[model samples]
Structures are given as C-alpha cells and as structure tokens.
Target: PVNRLDFGTSGLILFAKSAEIQAKLSKEIQEHRIERIYYAVVRGVPAAASGVISLPIANIDGNRRINEGGREAETFYRVIKAWQGYSLLEISLKTGRTHQIRIHLSYIGHPILGDLKYGVKSDFINRPALHAGKLDFQKSEFKIPELAAALPEDMAGLLEALQA
Candidate 1:
C-alpha cells in the first residue's frame, strides 16, 4: 500500500498506479511534504486544548510501544469537542509509523474508543473509532487529487450521543 491506515481505521488509503509513483510519494512522505489528518474519539478529555506527542515507537510482540530504539514519531492533536469521559480529537502525524497515533494516545491514558488492541472496548462500536479525515498533497510534484473523507456513520452517531 502506498499509504495505509490501521486495520480497523476507516478512510482514505492512497494507492500509486505504479512503483515509481510509490517511490516518489514515499520520499515525499519522509520529507514531511505529505499532509494527513485523522479523527478519533478517545476515552478521556485531555487537560490541554492541544499538544504534541513526540514519542518513539517500537514494535514488541506485534504491538507498537514507546521505546528508545524506535524511530521518532510525532503526533499533534487538539481537542475538537468534549463531553464527560470522552473527547474528540483532530490529529496530524509528522511521522508515519504503524499505530503511531493509537500508541501515543493510549500512552497518555486516552486510548481511542473501541480500540481493543490498545485498551478500552466500547460496545458502542465494534471497531476503533478512528477516521483518516483528510489528505493534502498540494505541495508535491504529483497532481494527485486532494482527499477529504467524512466521518463514518457509526462514529458520527457516537459523537452525537456524546454531545447530547
């Protein structure tokens, strides 16, 4: 996959028509020219309105965790909205490591809702309440059309209930 989201994550997954494009895009991603934003409903309200998580991640027993041996992964997140016990976050990643967002959020005691692999399970939904909200490649050489995906119904509904 040229770009990927976690298995239970729903939204845009970029695909390159050929390996050459894939290579170019990979380099662009590495240079931090690609813009990817995500949305997730988490277990608790963050104390601050926004903050950056600069945690290195290492895969241990098939799970990603914060470790010194891992590469630097940075995730910027802001509380979009909040209700008792939960908060919606708009997140952007500076490094694309497997489960980077999930790991960072979970480490902060705010695991994504229904993300059983990380922690906390919500019968409110079966899968992790995460969505790849947007993609921006405006600065890249490629003319790939920009993508902006809406939140899935299940997640949207969950937000509604929380708001209520």
Candidate 2:
C-alpha cells in the first residue's frame, strides 16, 4: 500500500498481482494513468462545488502531518450532493501519500465525519464516513483489460442515508 488511507476514508485501492506488475503500477501512478474515485460525507458543505488541493505531506515523528517541506500532493473534490447539514463529496488523488485525503480535507476546513486526528468527532456517526467508491485502469497484460467493484453494503447504506 502506498500509505495508510486514513482510518475511515475508503475508496479504490490498487494492488499489483506480481512484483513485475508492481513496478509497472508504480510507473502508471507516477504518470497519472490510473483512475481513482472516492466518496464521503463531510461535516460541512464546501464553498465550491469542485476544486483542488495542492499541498505537501509529511509525517511528524510518525504522526501524519501536512508539512510544506514534504512531497507535493494533489486532491480534487466535487460536491456530489448536499443534505440537511452535510454534503456528499467525490474525491480523486493525483499523488498518493499517507492520509492524503483526510489531511487535505482538513487543511481546507472540511474534515471527513468521524475523522479524529484531522476532524472533530461526529454525533451522527461513530466512524469516519468515507469510502473508496471506484477504481478504473487498463490491464493490457490481462485478458480482461478493465474491471470495477461496487461499494460495500454498509457504504451503500451510508449513501442511502445521505440521500435520504
């Protein structure tokens, strides 16, 4: 794994089937060839419907921190839908890093619900309301070149609740 995706953040996680594939996967990631999408229910609605977060990430003595001196990262997010007191968000990462989404969201003042380190606890939910919703990639070496997985039942439930 590139880095631990925050505690509740979910979405597509790409894993190589072989060592050789791992090298290719790394290259693809560096080249921005892979497509990843995430969905989450944040505490508050963001000002804009869509935008990007360009920041650097680093760990402060093993504690994840968004330090300016660290590697650059990019996070793009769009407001999927807004609810009574929250907004559903779709996020994509341009550069994978430890806790990239969580840290970036917090940096912009809209931390994911139930995200403790980067956000305040939520009374509505006990766990971080984030999910790795989908992933798309070309598998040139395999017979089936493309594949996708739907969100889990619990995650689907969260979406249902958000829409309700």
Candidate 3:
C-alpha cells in the first residue's frame, strides 16, 4: 500500500502487501479515485481563508518548477489556524505532481516553514514541515482499508511553538 510521499513529508504512507494490490490501487489513483490530504506549517498567513491553487508544473533541469508547459496541477487548501507570522494549513490534492504542494504554496507567497527550496529560510523546523495527515480510497467491492496518520513529534512541537 505504500504510495510515494515527498522526501520531506512525514505521516501515514500507504503500503500494498502485494504487487497485485499495488497495481489495483495504482489504477485507482490514475483514475482519480484516491484522495491524499496533507497538513503543513507554513510561513506567512494566507490572505484568503481558503482557496485553490491551479497551475501547471514541470521540471527545470533537475528541479520541479511551475511552468506553463508543464502538466496541470490542482491543490485545495484552507487555513486551519494562524499565528504571528505562521499558519497551520489543511491541504488536499486534486492532481499530483512533483512538489505540487510545496511549489504551489510558495507560489502563493506562503512557502512552508522549513522548505528552503520553495520557502524562506527558517530555524523553526528541520524539514519541509509537511505531513501526510489522511488518505481516502473510494472502493465498492471489498474492504480495502482505512488510512490516516497523526502528526509526528516534530510537527506537533512546531504547532505548540506556533500556539505560544
């Protein structure tokens, strides 16, 4: 069931016990039947309470970048909470692309706290400050499984810091 997570993202990762199941789930993902939700601690509060990021993404050399020539990528996000100059965001994906969330958030002027690639430098955390909070797979035949994960210690600590 293990699907891919960003290099810096931490949380529940789905893993298939067997290749057959993996293929089935992969097909479902391609068909847009799977949902991936993430939580992030980002820098700067969003001007809007909630919104969608619709953009195309492509790679520039070895790095992923938002480009008109790239594939269409869509992400929806809401500000769950906000602090002095930071925010807690609940984010979901409509289309998956490399660094989609990170790049999109950065593009919108709210790069993740620890995501130096697309965000400003920070000492608040050591990583991108993103977590795979939940996942849902639409099924009709048999019980596939339940997918959800709690925030890891590092992320939780960051939240506490923001709260104070």
- lDDT tens digits, residues 43-158, model 1? 99999999999999998787689999988999999999888999999999889899999999999999998899885788678899999988888878878677899999999888
Q: Pick the candidate with the highest lDDT.
A: 1
The better candidate by lDDT, 2 or 3, is 3
Task: Tell me the whole-model lDDT of each prediction, alpha carbons only.
Answer: 0.89, 0.74, 0.85
**Higher-lDDT candidate of 1 and 3:** 1
Alpha-carbon deviation at 3 in model 2, angstroms: 8.2
**Which candidate's TM-score is highest?**
1
Residue range 1-164, candidate 3, lDDT tens digits: 54688888898777777998878877777666777889999888999999999999999889898899999999999999988988999998888788899999999989998887897666558899999988776552325565789988988998887777
Measured with C-alpha atoms, the lDDT of residue 120 in candidate 1 is 78
TM-score attained by model 2: 0.81
Candidate 2: tens digits of C-alpha lDDT, residues 1-164? 52235665655566667778778766765676665677777778888999999999988889777788898999999998887767788888898787888888888888887777886576556777777776546633333344455665665676676667
Model 1: how far residue 12 lies from native, Å: 0.3
Give candidate 2 misplaced runs (Cα > 4 Å).
1-4, 138-146, 159-164
TM-score of each: 0.93, 0.81, 0.91
